[model samples]
Target: MEAGGKMMGMQLSWIRNPQVSAMLLLAAAILGLVIANTGLGPGLDALKHAHLPFTVFGLDLSAAHWVTDGLLVVFFFVVAVELRYEFTQGDLNSVSKAAVPTIAALGGVALPAIIYFNVAGADGAQGWPIPTATDIAFALGVLALFGRRLPTTVRALLLALAVIDDLIGIFFIAVFFTESVSLPHLGLAAVGIVAFWMLGRIYRGKRGSWPLRIALLAVALITWWLVAMSGIHATIAGVLLGLVLSPAPAESARERLEPFTNGIVLPLFAFTSASVIIPQVPLSELSPVFWAIVIALPVGKLFGVTIAGLVGQAALRVPKPDRMKLSELIGIALLAGIGFTVALLMNELAHRSAEDLIVEGTLGVLAGSLISAVLGAVYIALLSRRYPAVDSTERTARDSEEYLRRTDSE
Candidate 1:
């Protein structure tokens, strides 16, 4: 029993690591791709497209939709929890620390869209938002693997930048993807959200209360259902609920739910999203959307983030000691291009009408993200060698202590 318990503990520990989670996501995606191209492709495709056995609130969702619209909401909820923490206490608590990353995130978003517009023209313009995201898990995972000897500031800047980029990506999803909105359902969702927030506040004072926990879970599901029926994406419900929940309870929820999200939700989403049969055509015949995403993710993010971050630092008159070197900034900028998860969601939403475009978009996101990961790893490794004695692990430990102190005081 002791040995089995130890094995389970080790498995949980590995799943909690960002590096391991990222690798799982990648492996799932690759498995999906391979499966889609194999003799069993049709079976998997049919399974993904098949409707669920049951329907709630008169909504029938396919397996793929269940992953994206239902399970993926947990992932978004975690993101929103982190975003709220940053705004209220962490790096983005002050404008002085937030400006550069916010500016750089905007640049990272804009340039990719501009490139997409120019390359895809009117035909594929709907996918402009696809490449404008930075997958935080993948970026942080790569950094953790390669940034052993780097300073803590690099990770901080990357976190801020990725969080802000995702904020913009979420905005795009909420704004651009809605076909129609039902005011009645939306109103009900708003009420549910208010109830959720109030319950969270209550839970902060009533920890370990199972009834309250059950009520919270019930209210969250009701809200998500209302959002799904309201014609807005269901994931927005997670964001709204997370942002409104009180701090103490929110932190607890994040810790409890993070492992489930990392181990199951994200990997399921990735596998479903990437299970696209590669196009059989030559490169020249591929959709313009593919080429645009391929070019925009790495190149657009590199130039846009580097230039805007440099400019923002200069304009804000940052201290020399706080400013990152040009080379380090470039490396971080390259890392910003790892836009796997959100990009895939955007692609699926944008090209839902055209099956062929969806296939091409999947390939584009995977290929582009791979390029960014490779280049970013190399760049970060070179930077690590320059500061061999810095010890990022020690810096991370210090940061964690500071974070706990801030949270406790708050």
Candidate 2:
């Protein structure tokens, strides 16, 4: 048990290492691209659709579906935990703290959808949700690369916005993408959720309670299966379970699972989702779906987030010290365009039936996110030069200490 505990600790530490996680995601994506374009493409494609021999509760799915529908739950679970933390104790603990980002996130979602709708027109309009997501890991990873010159507030704002954006994406997945509903299965999932919640309350802080842990895991898996059967995305199961778990256990679970989600789950999902054949069609001949996503992500996100943030700051009469500067808001907006993970997931969910559109959509996400990253990095670098690095360092340390105090008190 001690050895297991130590191993888990090391794994948790690795998950906390942002640079490593980002590099893993990037490397996986590059490898997927390379493999998809090579002679191995057909074999990889076959493997993706290859079904397992066993079925769970009469449900059999392909390997790719298993990865997306099953393993991605872990990623969403971690995200839900982070969302809960932010809402309860972090930057989004209060309305004032949340207003700007929430409004910005809404704008971020709305405008990109509108842009996609207008650009793609009626025929290709189904993919409006494609550009509405912001990949927190990729965005933060880029911010980290630029060093400490940027204000801690920038990171805080980006995190808040990204979290809200994720909440919206989850809503879209649950509502828009669901093909049908099974009330009986949904009720079963609800029962599992309630049991999970009850177990959490009873087992909270009971370290080394292996039986309780096993029970909770069983309930979570059952909940996921039920939700999947109900025609809702299985990832919703992760969100529900994460939200219901007692705070202490939720944090512990997140810590334990983060490494696997970051290092394996996310990277594998990226690899599989990105393994699309590059279209041979000329750029001009590409469908509007391609251009819509390509344009909406970087351009739409920047316009939406910046405009909404500015309007929200004005409307809310946010204090000057708390208000984000125009340059900072622009930088955050640009970063919001790096919609990698969730964007890819949305693409798959949105264009599952249309193979040609899927290829185009994947390419668009990659292109748009890359453009956003490059532009956001340069903008932030220039913005950072205007601020004194010493001040940034002091502010960051103070913020960290404050955060620790809050956590301990909570």
- lDDT by residue (193-214, candidate 1, tens digit) is 9999999989877865779889
Question: After superposing candidate 2, which stretches have Cα over 4 Å from the reference?
Answer: 1-12, 390-410
Q: Write the per-residue lDDT of candidate 2 for residues 1-410, one digit (tens) a residue.
A: 42475456554564656667777888888899889999999999999999878887878989999998999999999999889989988899998899989999999999999999999999888899999999998898888766358777889999999999999999999998999999999999999999999998977657558898899899999899999999998999998898888886786677578878888998999899888889887999999999999999999999999999999999999989878999999999999999989999999899999888888999999999999999998988888889776565775577456534533432
Q: Following a full C-alpha superposition, what root-mean-square deviation does model 1 have from the true structure?
A: 3.2
Q: How many residue pairs clash in each candidate?
A: 0, 0
lDDT of 2: 0.88
lDDT of residue 101 for candidate 1: 96
| lDDT score at residue 358, model 1, on the 0-100 scale | 93
Report model 2's TM-score to 2 decimal places. 0.94
| Candidate lDDT values, in order | 0.89, 0.88
